[model samples]
Target: MPTLSMLYNTAIASAFVKILLFPCYRSTDFEVHRNWLAITHSLPLKEWYTSHISEWTLDYPPFFAWLEFTLSWIARLLGFDKAMLDPYNLNYVSTSTIVFQRSSVIVLELVLLYALCAYVRSMPARDQPNAILAAIDIFLSPALLIIDHIHFQYNGFLFGILMWSLVLAQKRETLLKSAALFAALLCFKHIYLYVAPAYFVFLLRTYCLSPSGYRIQFKNSIKLGATVIGIFLLAFGPWIYMGQMPQVFQRLFPFSRGLCHAYWAPNFWAMYAFADRVATFFLPRFGYSLPDAVNSALNGPTRGLVRDTVFTVLPNITPRLTFLITLFFQSLVLIKLFFRPTWRNFVGAVTLCGWLSYLFGWHVHEKAILIVIMPFGLLSLKDRRYLEAFRPLAVAGCISLFPLLFTPAEAPIKYLYTGLWVAILLKFNRAAPVPLKRQFLLTRVNLSYMAGFIPLLIYNGIVHRIVFGDRLEFLPLMLLSAYAAWGIFWSCISLIWLYFTDLD
Candidate 1:
């Protein structure tokens, strides 16, 4: 039998194979990007508003506008004409639009890929290369590659910069470079702003909490501030100069006036919506009248008289409302990081809380999966005190992948990515260099979280039928239930363990 290390390395290699080969699965929603390309490429700079795309595309961080603008130039070169493009019928499959768009996203991912590889290469020699490689393999695998490059949006570029900056911070070198990268990430996607608290904690410890004991070093703070300002100006200057500030805001924060997407992903928000319906059905003690139902515009094989029993206390709860609520929960996680400031505790809380927010929010896209899984990287790299905590994080990350595979969503290669996660978790558990006591703890905690899924699966697959009058329909809901429950439950377990044990 190959050593676990060799197996881990092989898994990593296989993951890369999947990423490179998986065909982009085009969705009806891809019209949004097509419309964006049409607007950016063909329209006069001032006329871009009339050709405005989906609201989601509008609210991206400012750096992405520059990216879109830059890509638009190439799209124009490739015969992209806004006059010929119809925003109402922008399905990528109908035109060459998707190919160019996906190509642009793939190029962006290479930046993330390079940053990720650089960070991995910087890992301490004492750690398991096999496990690190396995984890990285999972990150670069087909699921992430396809979701980022084809189906969803361009998040990898920003995420890449963030991770690279984080690694630089961890290494305590080139704080200015790290700050610049951090600003660039924020400029690309504002959603990542939720995790800024953790970044602040990282900078404080690595730079200000000097090895020189007592004296406070104020110079690093100035360098950090100046770097942040420099990058923010550099990224935003062009848009500001274009006199597109108003247009930019309209795009970046165009909150939809709706409760949920036509198709709800298996996530926390779905469960919460379900629970809200059940609550209103069983007990309306507060004079809560159910709101008008929003139709999903269903027209397919699965289309029928599908009834959502979800009740709303507030009749006009939109995506913006849910986003605000999610932001509130995210604040709690940030507060936890603020008080504790340890990488292990901080990263875990952010992962759990950030995921919980995304899971329950309205108009959620499957692309939101990254918010939950990305934190696992930090969790993996932090103190060994986190190994037990991270076991569940890894399991959750793997489970999150299942919904993408075998589902109607494009990018079928997600199965390979899912397999990579399984392989990494298994290999990490087996090949850890620590004592049996620590290893057993990690394994036990992982089992505890993984086992919790059984009840969740049963609830979604069968019990949801009893409760909601639909059995098979709620399978996706069940997956989300399992994910949300495990995240919250295991986090409690980790905190308790941290409190009692000498994790140091």
Candidate 2:
């Protein structure tokens, strides 16, 4: 097993790399956090959710607002301009501001580092290979580097909390603590709601009710219910007392956004949109003249607007339909957990639930792919089949995030770092004695698909500009989304098949 000193050194090395990226390209999320710092610092609790000074309002839960409020004080003490704290100071940027915000991300990632060490320590010696590989994979994940370090967000911190919850939930004695931690996580960021059903079903089956039989334990059920309710109350109690529940909820779940983001997430919806585009293009050759309304609806997805998408070639997908599809897939996994109620099964279900939501949920951001990928690290450790599924999924998912850091300076860094990480993953898998079969066809197919990214990246980054340029501005994004969606969609099906046939 790797020693504590080795793990600590690994963390130090990773932190050093993150520090070097302090001045890399940052997305508007940098401004969004700064705006959040200002709002949380200057405004009252009641105004936290209601303030619309910037388009990026306080959409995260109240606990996160409180966290930002706490950080603002430290930022102020570090010589950050107080004027930047003003709610109306939109697009404010300064060196001190950049240092404070970027440093905060680096500092908070320590939580993830700590949680990873704890997880590695908790695993048995026989499982050490998988655990160590998972830790390294997550630490060097291109998605984390892109989304958190460059694109700028607090996902690492939030996912750290999630890791602790998952680790705690594995043991029967710590189930209640896990529940409380998960409740707190949801209060911190409601995006974790994607995996809530797995947590709920697992806790209900294994803790509140009998695992082997269908008898409810009234006392345990009440205790679990009260514990969850109490955490939520602590998070929202102040707002509730001020009668701001509706406003808080509106900020939390804004159905007004759209069916797809400006860049469609690599998901089922992306594939659906792609198919619609193909049908619209070729159907005219078959002498089918669609109405103007139908053509207009079909054109919306191609334009990549941030409003509700209409399908000209197919039925328009409503938020309700997306919700139902998500629920149906989630239920399939949750039902499996209800019967099995084992720790491994619970982890698998959590991974599946995340995959379902990311694939079919309405308005999913590409960054949300982390929800599926992170838990998948856990599942991959237990089975080679999961590792197989993860290979393609991770490759495609990381590549799909390339568009986020499109600047010339950061482009080489993203690719080189990702290549290094993939090399490490491959080396570790080769060294591990997992008895993985060497399937020539499967290996060739995966390699071929992964290699396709070379051409895809070239076209999107260079060839597109040389060819159509601004005339076909959305073409690259559309192609990237559709291509990545196919890979992820196939991986999802492969995992589902493994769950039914191989998982016990």
Candidate 3:
């Protein structure tokens, strides 16, 4: 296990790297948060959600807006540039603005660092060393590097809260606090609704249900329900009092968005979209001309545009259908956790629930892969099989994030840094046992899947540009997304099978 001083020194090094990356590529998310600061600082409390001077309106839940509102005071009082708080200052990014915004992510990520330490400390003595490994890997996660620092979101801060909730759920005395923290997390960003079913089932089965028999713990159930409702009320109370609840809900859940983002998230839909493309266009080349509507194949879903998905050869996917599919798969994990709500099983259910949602959720952002990768880290240390499951996901999830840092200056950092992290994880993945033949077969298949990345990366970074230039600009993204989807799918299946059959 790493000594406390080692963890502190590593964190300092991570922060230094983040400071250097301040001048690196940042996404539109920079302006989004800057706009939030301005809106929260310059506007009245009543108009927080109503302001629309900038296109990046206040869409996050009330707690996050409140967080911004609180930070706005610090920005104003601390002598940072006050112009950054102008609601109409569209795309205003001065050096001070950049410093404040970037610095805020680095500092708030201390929350993530804290939560990881706490979770590691809370682990049983036998699991302490392995838990420390999870903490370190998650802290140094390539996904966080590309997505949070370069892409510029508060994901580290939010996921920190998630880790805290998970830690609390481990003990019976703190289960209510766990549920409350999770409820607050949802209000902070409802995307966490991905694992809501798991929490609900785990809390219901383990906490609210009598431990010995099937009798209901009505008093405990009411207490749990009230705690969750109270947290939501605290978050939404002001908006509800102003009678703008519908407005808040609309901004929070914009179903008007497309089935996928401009860049396909590396999940099931990426592969699904690819298959439709092949069936639509490739069939005609083999003299399988059937439908002229296939003429629209050129403008199909994988065009890398952010618009509602339209399928040419397959059934169109609606948000309703996606929700049902996500819920169905997540229900399987939840059912297992409902029966066996051990700490181990709960952690597995959380990871699988997030995986199912990311794979099947409508309009999933590629960054949501962190949802799978972070939670799965806890389970990976159990044995060789668990580490085997994590290996492909860690690799796929890491490489899928490479596209996020597409600038030449950031490419070396993502590639080398993520490469190092994966190597350390592979070393740690050692020491677990399996049958010789099964281990051999697994290693061979994993190596082959990983080997494909060489040509894929080469083609994406070099050959595609040399051959097609800007013509098929979206091809690289499609290839990366589809490839990662296969590996994540494999990991999810293996983990799910382990969850069902593995002894607690």
Candidate 4:
């Protein structure tokens, strides 16, 4: 078991590394939040969502806008010029601005650190070592490093709130508190809506209805419903009062962005895109030609556009179809949780829900892979099967974010840092006792597939630059996406199988 001092030391070390990464590569996301800070600071409350001075409009929920508003005050105190808050101050990258934004992420991540400590303390004495390992896994997560520290986002703070909610929901006594925290989380970042189904169904079955007899408990249901409604009302009340509901909804659910993201998130859709490419390649050999429109869509993903994706050999996926597919898979998992309603089952359902949504959701972002990886890490502590699946998924999913930080400066950092984290996790797993007999074939295949990442990284980082240069620019990204997709797809299957077959 890790002592409190040990946990504090881990957090301090993690924060120190994040501080060192302050000058590392940052994505357009840095500018996005800067824009938000500008919008929230300069614009009036009514113009918060309506302002279009910058392309990165205040699309996040009002609470997050409020959060930015709150942070801007502190930003101003830290020597950021008030002129930077101008609505049209696009791409403002002053030294003070950079330090302030990066510092905010580091400070706010303390929330995640606290939540991690609380979760570890909540565990049983025998499970503390595993909990500590899980905490380390999350703290040193490559995805978090790339997205939050380097690429730049507030996912650490957002995911911290999520971790707290999950910990609260783990016990029957804190169910209401859990619901309130989750409701707050949704308002903070609506991206979490993807996994909302699990929370809904779990609370409905275990809290709102009798667990053994399946009878409705109206009082409990009413309390849960009211708590959720109150939170939403608090979040949206001002917008509703101003009659900006339509604009708010539009900003929140921008279905116009299309099916797959610019970089195809390593999910079912990436495989679909790869399959379409294969068919497009072989169809000429089979004496078949695709329609020009279909062929045009095939070029879209390769070009990395944030628009509707068209398929040459497969049916173009509609937002509705993606939604239904996501819901269907989530329903299957939620129904299982509905029956069992154990803490492990609930956590499994949450992980599956996030995984299914990420796999099939429309306009998915590569950063959203953290949605699956974080909660799944929690489950990995309890079962060796989950750890087995988690090992490869973590590696592939984290590496898939590499293209986001493709600069020479960040390339080595991403690989070296992730390599070290993977080594630690692998060492820990090897040292832990396994109750189930090892499946040698599966182990060999998983290791082989994980090993392939080495060559893939080499090719993307070194060979591609040396050989083809910028001509085949998208080839490395495509290969990375396709390869990572295979691992994630397999991990999803492995987890679903474990969910059904493995008994508590």
Candidate 5:
């Protein structure tokens, strides 16, 4: 039976979305999303599968292109007009027509959302069915759906396939089905490559590791591998046979050198970017043109400052360098977990992998944080050992999301929804085992999280004054990093106290 909290959460989510439905459903990124659809639908068949297009739409995985192609054909059959959507002639397309076409995305997203909820509820829940539903509601709240659905991104589809894969894995129903689900996720988004390792780990543990001995179950492994390969071939085989593999890969994973996102998200990258900009201002001698006097001062007595500047700028390393560094750390973490093999450690390792990738990888979008945070948040809430680790993370995650409200220019509605969701999560957590007891530093941590937002507010106030100023956009991100930094600090202290308590 569902608890009152569960019922209330469901009702609230429904009411909230319905009330704000029109406002929340506006297409922010749908322009780009629609272009992707156009690329697939408007092009010739060969060109549709070929990825050497000069646009944002084709620069995605082959499976995504295939999906767009399929949808575009359906749209054409429905008599959708292309002249109306021509970016060159926005006036040509009536707003109502465009809205009608984009409505398909909302419809598809709703289906995916339903699948996600179903998968979450299907998870093994001994007695806390309400707790499980509440926990899922907390993660997949209106705010999240608004981001994925209204803002218009394929994250809904990717996350849907992911949750489906996880549910399949838990059931241990069919190895082929699980592999196919995972393979489909990979097709949906290349970022999901990080989670592929976890699938392997699971397969090794569940299927490859036989009870009789250390010998591998070659048959089951072969079956799983075959299913995964079959899905890949079905998605990519046609283009591969046509000798367009290079073009496909190039489009999907273009690793060009670029600056951090115009708007940074709170992570190591943004924090480093902030510190680097400051260091660059103070350091000298590398610029093309400067007065000799100023150059001399920078070159001569401030040599020590230059060295210090290097220290400050180190964290703001290039995306590729940061990618390698993050990869190294996550790999080490994954190895540690693979040996020890606890659910907490495994999820943490996977989260670290996905988080580090998003923070440091090239062409990252802020919203991608959901890829890691949502699943990890759900896992952390469900397990006892992960409770404290995730609580601070949850707080930090909420703080990180503040920039979204500002970016969308959402009014009080955004804040209200954010606050309500956070309160709901906290309330649900309070009822679970290892509830959030008001302990030492709890208030301080929350205060610190709130305090981190100040730099962003100040940065925003002064943004227009600077010449090359959009650095302010990074301020909120830096605050989020500070939140995470503080969370880690407090977590370490908590661990030390727990150790002593155990000894006592």
Candidate 6:
């Protein structure tokens, strides 16, 4: 059995390592948060959404804005107002800025620590050790380290709240609490909107309605309705009252950016974009006629962040199409959850929802892979099949995040740290035994895929630059994204198959 002290020691060790990275590279997100602090602290409430003083205008949901507001006081107490929090202090990098911003992420990560200890405590005695391993895996996650401590974001803090909510997901008594916490999480970051369907189906089926039948439980139903309404009212009430809700909505859900992020998240679309790129090259040589627009699209997807996610030889993807595709896959597991309505199935539904949306959602960030991995960690030890399903995603999804920290300085950090994380945690997270032949096949498949990474990483990290110095610069990203997508898609489908067939 794990104690609170040991779990927090894990958090503390991770926190110390995070602080060591304070002097390392910080992304544009550093400035983005700094500007948000300025907007919330200096500007009036009505102007929080309207402030265009910086290019990093406040685009996150209101609770996050409020979080920045709460942190701004600490930043002010640190005497970083002029150098860090001022919207006009664009790209300022003083010692005070580093201390304030980096320390804030480290401090906020305590929420994750709190969640880990509580989650382990909530588990049965036999499960506590495995839960501790999951907690360590999350804290030591290479992607989380790169994105939060180095690339710089509040993802740790946001995910901390999400972990707390998932802890409530495990018990029959705490289902409504889970729903309320998840609602507040959506308020903190609208990115959680991708998984809202799972929560909706789980709560409505398992909590709001009578478990034995479809008849509504008015008390539970009313409580859920009130919680959802009350949370949204707190997050959006001010803007709605001031007639600026449209503007906030526009900022929050700006679908105009493109189908994929500038750094392509490895998903169905990554594979889609790769196929389109390949077809654009070879299709013209086969005596196929090409449109003028498509002829010019040879470099469109690789060229970065254009208005449309153009494809030369394939149909262009619209936001609506991605939405429909996402919704369709979401319903498959959701329908299963509705039928089963068990805690194990509910957690699996959440994992599939997060995984599928990350796999198919419009304008997904590479960092969103954490959404899939974090919730899935809860279910990874449930059975031999669950562990088998997890190994693929845990390996592939972390590799998909490699591109996000592609700078030479951080490359070794990602590769080496992620390698050790996998070595330690996967070895520790044992599950119930399976048939010998099945386990043998699973081991071989895992070994083959894991071995493939050695060549892929070395080639991309070292050989690619030597071979194609700055020319064909996008090829490495394209190859890595496509390579990782296969594993991600395999894991999603395997877990879905499990949910439909063996969801006891």
| TM match of model 5 to true structure | 0.76
What would the per-residue lDDT of candidate 2 be over residues 257-363, giving only the tens digit for each residue? 88888899999999998888788778878998867645565457778778878776777899999999999989988888888887878877888999999999999
Q: Against the hidden true structure, what lDDT does model 5 obtain? A: 0.55
Candidate 6 pairs with clashing backbones: none
Prediction 4 global C-alpha lDDT: 0.86
Candidate 3 lDDT score at position 480: 91
- Candidate 3, run of 10 with poorest lDDT: 432-441
Which runs in model 6 stand beyond 4 Å of their true positions? 1-5, 291-295, 429-441
Every candidate's lDDT: 0.55, 0.85, 0.86, 0.86, 0.55, 0.81
lDDT of 3 by residue, 289-375 (tens): 657544455556667777788878778899999999998888878877887889889989999999999999999999899999888
Write one digit per residue (lDDT tens) for candidate 4, span 10-61.
8889888888888898788999999999888888899999988888888898
TM-score of 3: 0.96
In order of listing, the candidates' clash counts read: 7, 0, 0, 0, 2, 0
Question: Can you tell me which runs of candidate 1 are displaced by over 4 Å?
Answer: 1-24, 47-50, 53-57, 75-89, 92-99, 128-131, 140-146, 204-219, 238-247, 255-271, 280-366, 381-388, 395-420, 435-504
For candidate 6, report its TM-score: 0.95
Cα TM-score per model = 0.71, 0.96, 0.96, 0.96, 0.76, 0.95
lDDT of 3 at 434: 48
lDDT of 6 by residue, 1-504 (tens): 555566677777777788788888778888888888888988899999998888889998999999999899877876774556667777677888788889998889888877877788888888777677677777778878888888889877788888888788777688878888889988889988878888888888878788789998999889889988999999999999999998999999888888878878889999999898888778779988777645456446776554568777778889888889889988877888888887778778888888888988888888889899888877776666777788878888888877767567887788778899888756753444452335222656865786687899888888998998998788888888888888888888778877787728
lDDT of 5 by residue, 401-454 (tens): 555555445645555665566566555555445635434346445546545655
Please give me the total number of clashing residue pairs in predicted model 2: 0
Native-to-model Cα distance after best TM-score fit, residue 138 in candidate 3, in Å: 0.6
